[model samples]
Target: MDILLFLIIIFIASILQTSTGFGFSILATPFLLLLFEPMEAIQINLLLSLVISAVLIKKLLKDVDTGILKRFVMGSVIGLPIGMMTFLFIDLNLLKLGISVIILVLTLLLVMRFRMKQYKKRDFVVGGLSGSLTTSIGMPGPPILLYFSGTDTKKEILRSTTLAYYLFIYSISLVVQLIFAGTSKTVWVSSGIALPLVLIGLYVGQKLFVRINQTTFRIFTYIILLFTGLYLLLESL
Candidate 1:
């Protein structure tokens, strides 16, 4: 039953991620913690997220925002090491509690029609936040999602740029995890089992993306953010 349930979780999460370019880990990680140990769950989420990015990179490359991507990558390089240190020393539940609150508040603000100006270095800031969050919580989508949503970026650019950035961040994260925090064999086995489901979800999700407009995409993103924030809050409690 756990195996069956795990597949379902990954499939649905993959669909959201593939469609929006930023949700697989946010939607999947908390549930994965229920099915596996913390490190194992995190490793699985990272590995699967890498797969999602790899699969979508070719398709989404045309829409990638190179200028934004450059800043995000540079900022992420600084943030990754800090996140690794935090993962080792910080109280994860406490950190998660903080993140959850931020997610909730930001999501609410976005829903209230709050918007942000596009500053020159905003992508860098968002990317740094995303990188730290990725390693600390195994979920990076919230910061980028919030930033893009706040700036009211176009759906195509948002999806492509985020997906492109994930490829870089997820790869670095996996290497860091492997070096500093080794994974058990079970992590590999489980990720292998879920790969097919992830692929299927990606296929279906890409189809759905074609039909979704900006308004629909934003609404969908907000729903995911709300659920993610609520889930993290409940988990922390």
Candidate 2:
């Protein structure tokens, strides 16, 4: 029964990630938390995210906006350690509620169509904030990146850029977890099972995104985020 739920959630989350380049962690982590401890869930999710992002990197390398990726990644690098430190101090319930709030606010922005739609100046801000929040909250923040990119090019540029960002962040997290948490074996085993699901999910999401128009996609996006926010909010209690 648990495995079934894991597979189902991974499929949906991965598809969401494949098409939009964000939300896999946000959507999947909360579901995973229902079964696993928050720390374990995040570690495995990060590992799976790293693997999936690696698989997609080659295809999206040329498409990636290096300028945007670099600044975002650099900003993330600076903030990640701070977030990790802070995360260590916070209780699981608080973590869940905080992430729920972030998802709620972002969902509202998406529903109201308040994205900046510009990549240069706004991307730097978005990238920095996403980096910090992703590290702290485990959301990975592609929706924030999507809004900052402010163009339909999110399927391409933002997707590729976010893939790169996760690869980096998760790599760091893996090492940190091994050193700090000592749950590497458990996290690795679960991630091995989840990895294939992630790939399959992306394939499905890619197909969905390709077939749908932007407005239609955004509607789906908002609905999913609202649900994710509510899910986290409920789980936090």
Candidate 3:
């Protein structure tokens, strides 16, 4: 039964990651915690998310906003170590509760059609938040997703740029996790087992991406954010 759940989670999260460029970590890490130790779940999420980003990034290069991507990378460099420290010393449950509240509030604002203008500095801030989240909880999508959604970014640009940024964040976060938190064979082995599913998702998700209209895409994003926030809130409590 655990095996089945693992496969189901990997398959669904992979598809979501592939289609949306931001769902795998948000959807997978929390569920994986139910099956593995916290560090193990986080490591596995980082590894799998890295794979998805690496695979999709090349094709989406044209859509990437290089200027924003550069700023994100710069900001993430600062955030990565901070996140590692949090993972080492902070109480994860408390961290989850805080993150859940933030996600919920931002998601609600987006739902109300709140808009924000994109600025250079805000790009760095979003990147820093995403980077910190990555190492701390193996979930980096929330801040970036919410920010982009608030700015009313085009789906193609949002998906492509975030995936590009993820390629950097996930790689650094994985190394940070291994060094600071340690890992077990279970993390690597499970990640290997899920690789095939991720590939399958990559294929199917690309197909679905072309079919989803902008309105449907925003609706889907809202649902995912709300679900993630609520789930974390409940789990933390």
Candidate 4:
């Protein structure tokens, strides 16, 4: 039953990620935590996310915005350590609640037609925010999603660039978690079993991406953001 449940979650999350480039970790981690220990769940999430990005990188390479990705990486380098510090000292429950609220409110505003003008520097800022969130809360998609959605970035570019960024971030995160937090054998074994499911999900997600238009994509993004926010809020409370 546990394996079946894991397969189902990963399949849905994989489709979301392969299509939109940002939902795998955000949507999978919470449910994974319910079934596995925190360390193991997080390790599994990071590993699978890395695989998703790796699998799609070659295909999406053409759509990637290199300038934005570079800026985001530079800023993430600065934010990663700070996020680790925050993880060590901050009240985690409160942090979760705060992040959840911010995500929910920002997503709502964007849904209501709020716009943020795209500036060169905003990429760095968003990247930094994403990096911090990645380490602190194990979810990095909301910042990038919110930024792109607000700026009305095209679906193709948004999907590709975010996946490119995830390729880098998830790899680094996997290394850091392995070195500092450690993982169980179960995490590896489970991830291995789930690899086929991930691939299936990716294939389906790619198909959906081809068929989805901008408006539909935005609506999907909004729904994911809302779901992530509510999930975190409930967990924290």
Query: What TM-scores do the predictions have?
Result: 0.98, 0.85, 0.98, 0.96
- Please list the C-alpha lDDT of all candidates, in the order they appear: 0.91, 0.70, 0.91, 0.89
Q: How well is each residue in 99-182 modelled by candidate 4, as lDDT tens digits?
A: 899999999999899999988799999999988877766787889999999999999999999999998988887777777677
Q: How many residue pairs clash in each candidate at the backbone level?
A: 0, 1, 0, 0
Error of 2 at 160 (Å): 1.9
Q: CA lDDT of 220 in candidate 2?
A: 64
Write candidate 1's Cα lDDT for 1-237 as tens digits.
399999999999999998889889988998999999888999999999999999899988999999999999988888888898899999888888898899999999999999998775888888888889878778888989999999999999999999999999999998998899888999999999999999999999999899999999999989999998998888888
Error of 4 at 16 (Å): 0.9
Off-target runs (Cα >4 Å) in candidate 2 are: 117-122, 142-146, 149-153
Q: Could you give candidate 3's per-residue lDDT for residues 1-237 as a string of tens digits?
A: 298899999999999988888889989988999999989999999999899999999999999999989999998998898888898899978988998999999999999999999999999998898889888888889989999999999999999999999999988899888888889999989999989999999999999999988999999999999999999999889
Cα-based lDDT at residue 184, candidate 3: 95
Could you tell which candidate, 1 or 4, scores higher by TM-score?
1
Model 3 gets an lDDT of 0.91
Q: How does candidate 2 fare on TM-score?
A: 0.85
- Of 3 and 4, the candidate ahead on lDDT is 3
Stretches of model 3 off by over 4 angstroms after superposition: none
